[model samples]
Every structure is written in C-alpha cells, then in structure tokens.
Target chain A: MPQKHLVEIRDNPLFASIGAESFAALTRGAYVQNFPPHTELITEGEAADFLHIVSTGCVELFSIWQGRETSMSFQTENSTFILAATIKDLPYLMSARTITKSRVIMIPSQDIRGVFERDSMFAKSIVSELATCYRNAIKTAKNIKLRTSLERLANYILKLHLAQGGRIELELAVEKRRIASFLGMTPENLSRSFAGLKSHGVEMDGQVIKVVDAAKLEEFAHPNALIDG
Target chain B: MPQKHLVEIRDNPLFASIGAESFAALTRGAYVQNFPPHTELITEGEAADFLHIVSTGCVELFSIWQGRETSMSFQTENSTFILAATIKDLPYLMSARTITKSRVIMIPSQDIRGVFERDSMFAKSIVSELATCYRNAIKTAKNIKLRTSLERLANYILKLHLAQGGRIELELAVEKRRIASFLGMTPENLSRSFAGLKSHGVEMDGQVIKVVDAAKLEEFAHPNALIDG
Candidate 1:
C-alpha cells in the first residue's frame, strides 16, 4: 500500500467532507489490498465485512440467479462499492470481482460505523451518497421495467457517448457480453439489438460506437426516460 | 392543521432521530395539508419542493409513460414520500396521489438540508433510511429482470402472506389492476396468471388469497432467489 493511495481514499468525495482528523482516525486501521484481474472480492449471500473503496482499476458488481449471472454495476476509480450491505451488516446482494488489477482501501465496517456515530460531517456524507445511490437504483428499475432490449441498448450507447464528452470515439469500458447482461438481454439479443440501432443512426465497430445524429438518436431511444447517475 | 398531527410527524422514525429541539425547529415553518381521494399531490418531472410525511390515510406513488400509468409504491400512515428527490433537489421521478382522503406534513427541502448540516443523529438516521430504500429498489429491479409475471405474482403473494403474519385473511392492500402494473403485467395477464397460480396450490376468494400448499408455492416461486430485502 502506497502512502499516496491512502491519501486518495481520504480525499474521495465519499469521505472528503469528514474532518481531516476524523478521516485520518477512520483510516488508521484500514489496509490497502491489490487484486489481479478476475479476482472475486466478495460473493453474493456472504456476510459483508469491509467497506471497500476503489482506489484504482475497475470492479464489476453482479448477481447470480439459478447459475446465470447479471451485471448490476461497474465501479471505477474513486467510487465505493457495497456500502449499503456493509452498513447493514447484511448478506451481499451482489458479488464483486476485479475487472482489472485493482487497488482498494478496506476499512472495517465497525470502524466506519464508529466514525459515523462520532462525526457529523461523515454521517452527512454517507446519507448524501446513499440517497444518490437510491435514486440511481430507481432509475435502473425504470429501465428494466419499461424499456425493451433495443431501447435499453440505444440508451446505453447514448449514455456512453455523453460520458465521453458527447463523442463516441472512446473505447467502451466493458465488453459486449457484460453490457448485454447489464441491459437484461441475452448476447444474441444484444447483437441483434445493435444491428437495429444502426438503422436509427448509430454506427458501431467493435467496441467503438458512433452516434451520427444525437438528436434523432435521443428521440428514438427516449434517453430522458432512462436516467443514469 | 392540528398540533397533534405535527407531533405525529415529529415522532415518526423519519424525523425521530433528530433531537427533539431540532425536530421542533423543522416543524416551525411546516404546515399540514389535506387532500381528497384521487387528488394529485406531486407530479412527475416537476421540481421537488418539500419532503412529505404521511400523517393519515394512503397515497399512491406512480409514474406515467406514453399515456400509460405504473404504480411505483404505496405510502400509508407514518411513512415518508419522495425523500430522494427532495434531498437531491431534483425533479420528482413519480407522481403522488391521495388514494384515500389524507393528511400530510410538508417540510421544505431546504429545511431538511439545513437539519442535515446542523445535526449528526438526524443525518445518521437519514443514511439508514436511504440505504434501506436503495437496497429495496435494487431488490425490486432484480424482481423485474429475473422473474416472469407469474413467478413475480407468486412471490408477491408469499411476501404479502409473510407481511400479514403468514395469513391471507385480510383484503388485498391494492387492487388487481394496480397490482398488475406493479408486477409489470397487464390486468388481463394478471387475471390469467392468478388462475394459473391456483393450480400451484393457491386459492383466492375476492381479495383473500390462501396457500393450500406453502411448500409447493415456494418451490414454484423460488423464494430464495427473490428474497432480496
């Protein structure tokens, strides 16, 4: 664990608002761990032991049902994972795995709870983060319940385009299969859905997707209805 | 607005963890409002103004798309509504309407944010509440994506049965039409689905549903996979 990575975790917005002294105290017992790509960090239905803060690389949060896996979220640098399950001391609802060699700060949930009880700013930050997460979850539910596989793919492409400064030249953050599962569709359906979006003004070459007509694609995809954080 | 209603709002778990003095300050500029059945209290996509606390009666939180309505959640006595939108100062995601003649306590979102900045316990309580809501939303998303309409209904019935102390003697809390929308199906589909469940050992008399073979129903519903919250 490098000293610089420790500073990064303390500076992340999830803990940034807490007083420096309290943040330092909270992380004093924390440790940094590194995992290779494809390493399983936590398994679904297992007791959550630590509040994991992603310092570098990527992690995929997913759930398995009847032996089939569904991707729930993808966490990158500066994001935290599984805070709700850790806070509640409940079984992990989703499993987490390292998508790339990753660095993460691990703080005991008990220590985090102690800081929450003793530091007002820390608790406020926690509440704000949780609220944002809750809102995002609702948005995800709307996507799942109301939209078809094709519509979801269109929205996802549009979102990725916007996330990369309103351009589609950036490489996709995840593979097509993972994206397919995240959008609640099969790989074959996703392939067909991508072909359908092409006629609606989207052009994809491998992982690169181009939105030829942003306004027309927006109308076709109804992106406004599928909100994202 | 009765003083007793103010007391009830302050005493509800949503505000209970805030100190008594802080709670009083929260209610200082608040007011009680009454609405008749079917009155729309909050419209989706409009700017959020206040955090609502239900004092009496019931309210349905729903969303509209392409001229179709979907029920998102139902709120009753002592429950709060739209906290996520209010806290984030974002537009409401769902419209709320009175299902029965209702009394509601409206606290300005500004005041709620003020309390968060000034009180730690209040903030902590908000974190717990929001985390629970977020987890529940995730569970709902899982339900929508992983289960078919009949499987969803079967698990929903079991959940209702468990919620009512493993008994189904009481009238259903919501109508079949609303239940259909909540379960992501049409009313006609729900009717046929209910008939299908009867073959799996469920018996229904009007709103009253009885599970003649709980084990068989659980097996068909795959309760463990659906047990998220």
Candidate 2:
C-alpha cells in the first residue's frame, strides 16, 4: 500500500494516467521529503536533475533580475512543478521555494526521461500537462495585459471566493505583499485598490475579507473567463 | 517538391526532428494559405480544429474582456500558434489575426492527435515544444510582474535592436498601439516612454527607431535572457 501522501500523489491526474509499470518506474527511486518553510527546492539557472511534486503545503516559483525578485506562480498540493525542466533537461528558469512546511516527492530526472521514452501514455500525460500549463500561462499573460491592478485584484478576490463556493467571508491566501507583487502592483497600490473597491462590494479587515455584494463585485470586476478563470 | 513556404516550414526544428513518416503523415493534409492583413484566422471560444503554422509575415494573439482587447503574442515565420489548444482539444482563449499579409499552414487537428500517439519521436517533439512554450510564458509573466511599463519599453526596444543584430536603427515590428498593448501599456504611456528613453540613448521617428548608444540602452533595458529572450 502507498503511504498517505504517495496515495494522494498517485491520485493526481498528471501521473495517474500512466500505466502501472511506468508509474512504478517513475516512483521506483522517488523519495518523499519534508521541508521547512522557506526552503529553497530549486534555484534558477541550476541544472534540473529531479522532478518535484508538492504533495502538501505550497511552493512558489519566482525569478530575479538585477537583485529584484517577483513571484511568478504558486503550486499547491498534489501538483507537479518543473515538469518542463525535467522533460527538456534544461536549467530551471525560475527558483522554487516552499511557502510553508511542505512534503514533496522527488523523482530523479533520468528516471522520468527514461520512462517517458518507453511509455506512450506517460508521454501523452506530459504533453497534456504541458498544454494546460501553456494555456494557463497565456491566460495569465492576458490577465496582466488586459486589466489594471484594481481590476486584477477584484477578479483575483472573486476567483478566490468562487473557489470556496462563494462564501461571503474569506481569508486571503498569501501575504498582502506577495499578493500585491503577484498582481503586479505596489503594496500601497493594492491597499488603495481595495479601498477603491469598497463601493463595488468588497470589505476587508487585515486578511479577512467580505464580499458584501457579489453581483456588484462581479459588475466592477467585469470578469471574463477567457482571461480570469 | 515542397512549395517555398513548405520548404521553409520543413526546416522548422519543431517538426524536423520527428520521423520522416510522422512528418509526412502530419503534412499529408496540411496546406498553406495566405491571408490579407487584418484577417481574423482563429477566434476565441471556437473549436480548435486546426493547428496553424505561420510561414510568412506576422500574426498576433489577443483576448477581449468586456469589449476591451489586448494583444497577447505575435508569431512570425517558422513558428506555430495555438498548439496548446490544438493538442488539448480545447476552445481557444485568444483570437488570432494576421498583422501583415501572411501565409499559414493548417493541419487537421485529428491527424496531428492520431499521429502523436503512434510516433514517439513526434510526441517527444510536441513535449519539447510545449515545454518551451510553458517556460516562455513563465518568463513573460516574470517580465510583466517585475518591470514598469517604461522599463518594459526600453527592454522591448533593445530586444528588437538585438534581434536585428544590433542594428542602430530598427523599425517597430507592429503598430505603436498594438506594441503598447502587447507590452501591457497604453499608447499614451508608450509615447511618454519613448520620450523618457531619449535620455537612455533611444531615438524615434514614426515607426523608425534608432539605438544611438547601444551600451547606454543595454544598461537601461537590463535585458535578461530568462525573461526577454
């Protein structure tokens, strides 16, 4: 029987589609390791020698230029990170670090590359995952290009709310600073954006938020699934 | 014999690496057609039944939200667009339109999917291409999150200059307004950005641009291959 986390990972659609032999081949040498919060799992420009799966907690992908850093994305439980790097055997373009104490599965890159060549289903899974990743990224690029930070914050908060079945009250997922960076705005700008949105149906106290008027918020956000969802 | 554009596309490394039989199967029903500038080729929310490869001139991918539109990406010769949608059999999130009189080859989506499973080399090629696309999108996201519109414009101009082998003066590839959208800025901001860049060794005349001081421009742009390239 697989360990609890392993069982969860086995259920992941990204790897579940593979045959038993290929999945076994991939996980034969794979090991689960617990990491402390803020642990650096992979550094940008470093050789990618392993494929990492976040079995629990969260991991962030970020990049640095001229000593300035920006968070690119976050991956939570049961998702694989850096499949592209492992498949291409290329240097990681973004560094990944644990946002919280996390359990991660590490599969050697060689194992994956070897099995991918021999396993057609596994190859298809990789292709499908990559296709999804590519589409998500394009959508994100659209989100960044098409909307102002205010609109982005509204849609993001609305997305968060919807993900939890549209409860009126919710908690912010990441720190306001991180959220500000993720939305491509300054902390001050984010604060003002939130304040500007009060008339449009949002109320917040620290990290706690309330969607006082969902329809009004939606109207203000002008949310479009093509870009936001 | 392959037509002139087909000859060029046959040299495309994306398909060239696949086995000859897979390549032939892919191209058996592939046909290249030219369109007048501004022709809409692929509309968002439509079934992705064909994979489009740009053989000549230019095309842009863009999205609309509440009647507002922003350009997402531009594809030129020897490049494929909408691979993600075609591979995943999903609706396109972005619409594609010709920016110039362009030739594009359309391959029936079913043929590509059928060939992908049977031809491992072609499957690998698709994986590689998708991986590249994913990485590029991550880089683009980083660029948007990390830089201000002015910095982005400086880097954009430098990238254009370098792409043309560091030619002192290079014409803008797209209209200023469209370039502004692609860079996540307003046309007014782009004009002001050009004015700001004058101090950083950039000169502009209509669509014609001159990088008068290459080192100065590079210093300002801070071009990073991980993001800009």
Candidate 3:
C-alpha cells in the first residue's frame, strides 16, 4: 500500500485507536486495489472474507431478493462496509459494487478478529463502531416505516443539503436511480417525488438540485435528527 | 433484583461470558420491574439511562415520526433493547411499550460502560450482539424494500410457524394492528394481504393462524436464511 493510503486507512475511527502492533498486524496482509466503475466487489450470501473500506470514490451496498434489487446504502471515502458480518464471521447480507472508479482497502477478517481479541482498545472501538452501525440501521428502518416516499426523498435532499453546508445549489452524489432505490421507490416515483418537492422550493435539473427556498424545504421535510441522522 | 432475574439477565449472550465481579457490578445497581400491557417503558429521543432486558413477555420497539408510528421489533425473553444507545450514551431511537404484561431488568448505562471497559469478554460479546442487531436491521430493510405486503405477511407467518417447531396451527402473539404496522402495511392492507394468502393455504381466526399447507406456504414465502434470519 502507498503511504497516503495507509494514512487514510489509519484515519478511520475503527482503526484510529488500535495499538501500533495491532495496526501493523492488520495492515500486514492487507492490500489496496482500484476498482473500475460498476465492478461488483462482494455479493450477498457469500462469506464475509474481507473487511472493506472505501478509500475514495463510491461503493453502493445493495441487496437482491426474488429477482428484485434495492440499494441499501452507499459508502464513500473512509466508510467501512460489512464490519458486523466480518466481526460475526457471517454471510454478507448486502452486496457491494463500486459506483465510481474507486480505491478500497481489504483486510482479512481473521486479522480483524485476532486483533479484536488481543487488543482491548481495538475491541472497545469495535463496540462503538458496531453500535453506530446498529443505530444507523435502526434509523434507516424508522425513516422507511414512518415516512412516505415523498417525505423520504425530501429528507434525503435535506440531509444532502445539510451535509454540503447548506449550499443553495447542490449536486447529488449518487445517480437518481440509485437514490430512488435507496429511498425505497422506483425511478418514476422519484421523478414524481422531485416534482412534488417543487412546491416546497426544490428545483432539479438532471444531477443538479437548487434549493430555491431553504426555509420552505425545511418546513416541508421536517427532518428530525433522530430519524435523519 | 431477584436471583431468578439475575440469572436470566446473565444468561443473555451479551453478559454470559463476563467475569463474576463484572457481572456483580452490573447487577448491583440494576433492578427488575413488571409492566402492564400497553405500558410505555421508554420514549424515543430520551437519554438511554438503562440497558433494558425483557425477562418475561413481549416489548414492542416502535418509532413515531410526525403523527405516524411503526413497529421496529418485538423483543422477548432474554432479549436486550437499545444496547447501542445505552453503550454510546445516546438518545433512544425507538420507544418501547409492553405488548403483554412483562417483567424487565434495567441495568444502568454507566455500569454497562464501566464493565465494558474492564471486561474484554463482555466487550467481545457486545460486538457479537451489536453485529446481530445490525444484520437484523439490514434484513428488515431488505424485507421491507424488496417484498410487498403479501410477501412480507407470508414470510412472517412462515417464520412464526418455523419458530413453533413447524406447527400446523400457530398463534400470533401480537395483534393484527401491530403485525400490520410491523410489516409496513395498513390494517386494511393486512386484512387484504391475509386474504391474498388464502390461495397459498393459510387460515386465520383472530390470533390463531393455521398453516393448512406448509409446502405451499414455504414455496410462496421462499424464506432465505440470509434475509429472513
């Protein structure tokens, strides 16, 4: 691995607190690779052999059932995928594919479990990281169950709006189709939802979204920290 | 806490492997209480002061947004609720209510974190428990996003049937309204979905559900371990 990639991987909170020895051991057999856009990195139902962290660009975590697929989440830079599966040594519950040409770090699950057992700091960090993941999943479920598709899309845009420092004009990171799937709607429904948001002062043109009135959008979305975060 | 409650709490996989001293420290400040049906145990967005364990009966973990409420999960005996929030000292994401007359054990969050720091085994157990929670949430997302109301109800009934040792006649412990909410459908939709399942050989009478044709139900439900587990 390059010095820069090592630094970026180390910056991840999951690896930040580990002892130097454990960190070295974790990275010893680890390898970094660049994936082309649309590359399938891992598939659901397969053994979680490697713990994957996106170094740059994007990776979409998705699932398929009865010939239908839906986007679970998208992992960008520094985001880890399937830590719970790697920790539990279970089958991957969601598949991963690179949405853009990306760099990713793959560490052996054995090394992860080995360090988790021998290093208390690493173990504690795993607890915190896993807790965060669990909470996020619960939040996702709540967002889906408690809100309509329009509300989901509205809050999703508000989330991106907030994430981008409340810019009046923001570009969506993921494609509309993937965003639609993540928000549990069809592409057609997403288009319709975006049209519906026009009344709330959101205007869209392809990938670019312009928040015409932030106050109106916020009032309409009612983005709650507990659900949105 | 009573000796029985202490033993049951210890039996939880999260606490099963901790040292006696750590276990004693955890239970020292803990207390067990019984709640009547429909009792609200914890509200969403409140500080997670206690790590709750359902010692007896059922507790429904649900969330409310605006005026709509949805069931997240129904935790039963030996199941822990909101461990991630308790460990992280964050607000509860979902409010829990007793669906049946219930006995619950409450362990203080401070003690949980204290013992977590001192006990490596306990920390590792927390990793496993949290991982399980995370994966369950993903499965739930897939179930909601990928399956329709009828499919969800079919699989849910199939799950209950399997849990009852493949019994031909299985009783739904929860009411139809709650099951409908949990499956992300309206009560009218739930009734319609149940009616839709009649072609697959299922019969419903109040809370009693009879799997008239197990083979047909399984073929229709197609319960996959990766998604259903």
Best by TM-score: 3
Per-prediction TM-score of chain B?
A: 0.93, 0.95, 0.98
Assign candidate 3 its CAPRI class: high
Query: Candidate 3 overall Cα lDDT vs. reference?
Result: 0.92
Tell me the TM-score of candidate 2's A chain.
0.96
Candidate RMSDs in Å, in order, are 1.9, 2.2, 0.9
Candidate 1 per-residue lDDT over residues A47-109, each given as its tens digit: 888889888889999887666678888999999878898777777788899988998888888
Residue B215 of model 2 has an lDDT of: 95
What DockQ class does candidate 2 belong to? Answer: medium
Model 3: clashing residue pairs? none
Tell me how much of the true interface, by contacts, candidate 1 captures: 0.56
Candidate order (lDDT): 3, 2, 1
lDDT of 2 by residue, B27-126 (tens): 8898878899999999998999999999889999888877788888899988887888888888888899999999889998988898887888788889
Over the true interface, candidate 1 deviates by an RMSD, in Å, of 1.7
What is candidate 1's CA lDDT for residue A55?
A: 84
lDDT of 2 at A26: 79
Candidate 1 residues lying further than 4 Å off, grouped into runs, are: B225-228
DockQ (Cα-based) per candidate?
A: 0.62, 0.74, 0.91
2 or 3: which has the higher TM-score? 3
User: Which residue runs does candidate 3 get wrong by more than 4 Å?
Assistant: none
Please provide TM-scores, in order, for all candidate models, with all chains considered together: 0.95, 0.93, 0.99
